[model samples]
Target: MRRLPLAILAIALLVAGCDDAGASPAAQGSTAPAASAGGACQLLDFGMVNAKLGLDLSVAAGASLDNTFTCVLQAKGVSYPDLVLAVSSTTIDADVFGDMIQPKNATAVQGLGVAGYQMPTPAAGKAGPGVEVGWLAGNKRIIELSLRFAPGTPDQRAADAVPKVVELAKLIDLSSL
Candidate 1:
């Protein structure tokens, strides 16, 4: 019985390996992909991220569809900043942010980019620890770097993550778009 399942599994693995997938997801060298429509984000090189964040990062995988392009960066398979970062274009203007209900510790930040802000987790009780930094590139686009820590994470650590994400946002070159 065990041999039967092993044979079936082996055949499935062999078939998957033979599938004609597209080119490897790794971005070649430092050249970035072209900006998508509506003009919100540009493909960023891993070295650029490492230089900005002071950590070695490499692309784990990527995809491009129409006006959107996304590349995931990781260090030894770990997510960048141990969380998530998104630098992409959107049709909506920055004024949409005016409707946001600021969390307990959201603070307006100046000059991380055209404009920026940091949002920290609430100070009390049990809530997921998260921090986000949002930056505006004029009115047509906004870039955000965010991190979510394990529940019950120390408030100070959540507070600290916000600044680091803001630093990462500053590295993006909006003019290149």
Candidate 2:
């Protein structure tokens, strides 16, 4: 369960490098890992996304990175070129992790089917960092919105990723999974 953040980090690096791609104000980036049965969960398709968010996802071929429940979208005029929407029925319970970040900075979400928070992740290069917004729903299902931009980008662009995650979280229904 402890490996959850590293796994998330690996994904972030992938997203940073266009490689691949948790929650809680539990610390901005901290997450409590729980065990859950995999393979049974359902991932939302691109059609489920709201076009108004500027995330133009299509049901084109190879759009999905992980066939089971992961969709990767290519960015157009958007600030971030790599956007990943991933849904999972993770066993890790987020409630047990305490608070990842101070409640002040963490945005308390309501009616989103779960307790969600947004955390900014810092990177080594010039691109700055990306924000990961995640929530726990139903039993142990976790829905995460990971957004990464090109390296050495401006800090404002990195900071802009937070609100986007929250907006997308509302559009997704974790219970359906």
Q: Which 10 consecutive positions of candidate 2 have the poorest summed lDDT? A: 21-30
Any idea what lDDT model 2 has? 0.47
Poorly placed runs, candidate 1 (over 4 Å): 1-42, 64-68, 79-83, 91-93, 101-105, 112-115, 121-130, 148-158, 173-177
Q: Quick one: best lDDT, which candidate?
A: 2
Please provide, for model 1 over 29-141, each residue's C-alpha lDDT reduced to its tens digit, 9 standing for 90 to 100: 44343232111224455555555555554333334334333333444433223333344454544354433422334577776555567777453332357676665556345
* Candidate 2 structure quality by residue, lDDT tens digits, 113-138: 55776666666554446666666666
Q: What C-alpha RMSD separates each model from the true structure? A: 12.5, 10.4
Best TM-score goes to which candidate?
2
Clashes (N, CA, C under 3 Å) per candidate = 1, 19
Instruction: Tell me the whole-model lDDT of each prediction, alpha carbons only.
Output: 0.46, 0.47
